[model samples]
Target: MRYDVVVIGSGFGGSVAALRLAEKGYSVLVLEAGRRFADHELPRTSWRVRRFLWAPALGCYGIQRITLLRPAGRRGAGGSRAGGTGRGKTRAGQSGGRAGVLVLSGAGVGGGSLVYANTLYEPPADFYADPQWAGITDWRAELAPYYARAKQMLGVVDYPRTTAADKVMRAVADRMGAGDTFRSTPVAVYLGRPGERVADPHFGGAGPDRAGCTHCGSCLTGCRVGAKNSLPKNYLWFAERAGARIRPLTTVVGLRPGPGGAGYLVDVRRTGAWAGGRQTIAADQVVLAAGALGTQRLLHTARATGALPAISARIGALTRTNSEAILGASVPRRAARRRRLDFTDGVAITSSFHPEPGTHVEPVRYGPGSNLMGLLQSALVPGGPCRVRRWLAALAGRPRDTVRLLSVRDWSRRTVVALVMQSVDNSLTTYHRRGRLVAGHGHGRSNPSWIPAGHRVVRLLADEIGGIPGGAVTEPFDVPMTAHILGGAVIGATRADGVVDAYHRVFGCPGLHVLDGAAVPANLGVNPSLTIVALAERAVAHWPVKGAPDRRPPAS
Candidate 1:
């Protein structure tokens, strides 16, 4: 079938593009590589790893695809193979190249929203001061109204400060003399009376029915109660009602110029079926919204295979991870066994505060029965070559302490994780090797440890909370895992600087655009969902109406 616009990957960017283009009277087709999840279909708990995680080859097709690469090991890493089974660089998956790509992202129809903490924060004023983004359309001013529109569409609101974790975050902020920076996080969950089911409040009663937030703290596991405002609940939801077609479990495999150079041809393979089959379709325009990893991999493949040689050489540069760190502590022994703190009583991130300039920390939690994350933590140790050695020493020296954390009884209720993010600029370039996309850090920076500010705050929080502080397993290995991975196909003044223009159009491939995290040029030191959505809104706003004369400059 032919479409006026074919949007790939139904995440924040793709969903907004599909909805907007459809609104402009275009026949839109949105192809999602993951399955469409119904509210009841969401896993009740995250422990069902096989059902809650996403690894199609492993028969797991839910949200939350956790990719872990063992940093650059001895002899310098060349990248690792990816997939549920089979061993080859030709398979369809993101390769963890030389330096390794340790990231936490979402899958399925609604993309990250299906598994995100739902925090919708606007970046601080200084975000616009980055030299890399200077003179790029006065971003803050241009996006102000769009940010408001995105907030309204996503149902963003100030978090209700009613959880123990919330109080703890505020207290920590006050004790540090930064009380003014401590505030409730803006979240996308419904705030009507708890457990109340009401007609859609944001879409003039024309959208899906939503349930009020019950504060299950399971936003990362998928919102089974419909309180979480995932993309399917808003943009994608409305797009379908407005004549856009959404096909889930269909993965795009190839792209080539269309007949007569008026459009493009796209090939897709069916996911989760035996004896793979393929189909091709035509689209006048293509908008990539496959998140950072997915979009980077696809664009890299296209460029390397000569399918789209016109793409800029800067296809996968400036990949940012929000300078992120996952740091937190288990509840104190006295509080855990006596006071019985319920860490899972509120939204995923109830409150946050700035502990240092360009850095922000928020209290993150999981719902009851979701103790799987406990496995990702280890004893916190200071940075250096001996960090991993020290962690091992602590583990071997205190076996019982380790066992206590691994035991699942009330684990979710007894622990809180701090989601740390920073605006500090640093990046890696991704390139294809042996048919897999891998990142390469320039100039011998083999291992870049987490920012020291993150470590300091983590240590302080652990001390104040009366709990044993710990760091993510990757931290010891000089690799900090991140949830908000941005950049890669970023905006720039020319093709030499970036793959896309400020308008999100490909530098050489007209009618092809990147409107996702991949287009983001710098870290915002906050959850990037709201920023991505606002940027997408801007990308769509610049697009001429479908069937109208194309106003974009012709490829040079």
Candidate 2:
């Protein structure tokens, strides 16, 4: 079948592109690799633990596991596919191997928006002024209108400061003497009048009506309360209404220029255990919105096969992990207050503090079923060969005991989970190897500005609130983790310096464009979902449709 636009991947970038293009009267088809999930389909209790974590054999969640290998000398090894046909399939059909480094990301309809903490902040001014961004377009002016559009679409709002957790965090910030940096995080949620819901209120009755946020702490576990404003509830939902067909559990495997036309042919597979099949889609325009890892892998494979050799060499360069860390502490409550009620009940990240330059700290809350508290307890136990060893031992021995102890203790009353981040510019690159995206390892210089700032905030928390010091953790490392990953296929002035031009069009390919985080030139020092949405809006706006065109002919 043919579409005016074929969008691969349905995360922030893909979602926005699909919606905007469809709104412009284009016949759009969105191919997503993961299955569509409703709130009920998501696990709300411990009984459904398997659904929360990814495992190929057990009907994995959308998060893909990645490995970071040391760069292969000057000349890297030729990339190849590991197993059957390079097609996505049920767990039984997937290749059996482990990645050297494991990076987690969401798949399915909403993409990372499903699992990400909805924190939205603007990029620093210096980000737009950088030489890397100057050549593509005047990012500052181009992005302004779109950012406003994205904000209105996502229902971005600030915390009410009414929750007890918010007050405590503010008090802690004040005691630290760096209280001036404390502010309500701008989140994508509604805070309007009671019982009255309106969709697309900002667009004059064109969007969906999102019920206001109830402040449920279960945003991570899937907001069953209809409060947390996720993309599925807004943009993607509206896009479907506007006539875009969202094909979930459909993974695109290959892309080749359309037979004698200004378009391309896309190969896709329906993934599942019951039954699966393959199909081809033809499109006049293709927008690659798959996140950094997914898009890099797809583009690399396409380029390597002579499908599009004109693809710039800088395709997988400037990758950044947003320079984030998860630092948290536990506050033990008196035995009398332990069993009263669930303090975590209506709290969805209520406060934040920046104790020093370049550092950001915020309260992290977990639902009843989240094992985060147990993880924190394990990290706190003293004594072991090393921090890793100690953490392993704690994980094995103390998780249950600590949970039982905390179940009776009022930790939520006195404790606030904090995440500390520095605006350090360290980054890594990603490339395709054996049909998969792999990150190259090696730490760039750690920015001292973030470290000192982080330490200052940590010290204040420990001293003022009498909270215990904790360490950082990510997917492979037992430290904290972040959902924001940016860069890779960056935008540049010329094909030699970057993959796409200022307009987000491929350096050489005319009808091909990349309109997602992959186009971001630098880390925004904040969650990137909102920025991606805005950028996508700007991209589609630049390419206004001139009525619908005829479908491209089939391949010979």
**Which candidate ranks first by TM-score, i.e. highest?**
1
Model 1, span 161-208: residue lDDT tens: 668887777777777778899888899988788889999888899999
Which runs in model 2 stand beyond 4 Å of their true positions?
45-47, 54-56, 62-104, 192-209, 273-276, 332-347, 372-415, 441-452, 462-467, 473-480, 547-556
lDDT of 2 by residue, 1-556 (tens): 9998999988888988888888888899999877777766765732354555545456765333323433433343232211102111112211111112234466667887776667777776756764556654678898899999988878788766455556656777787786787787888766565334556454576655555656656566565555566778778988899899998877778888999856999988866535458788999989998787778777888898889887877766666555555554554444314534343644456667766544567776666656433342324432112545655676578665345434424444444566655454444556676766665421232111123344445555555444554443322232224445677788776776778876678877768889888888765666678888888887777666646552332111
Model 1 stretches with alpha carbons more than 4 Å out? 69-98, 332-335, 442-448, 551-556
Steric overlap count per candidate? 0, 11
RMSD of 2: 8.3
Clashing pairs in 1: none
Q: TM-score of every model?
A: 0.92, 0.80
- For model 2, where is the 10-residue window of minimal lDDT? 81-90
RMSD of each: 6.3, 8.3
Candidate 1 global Cα RMSD = 6.3
lDDT of 1 at 462: 67
lDDT scores of the candidates, listed in order: 0.79, 0.63
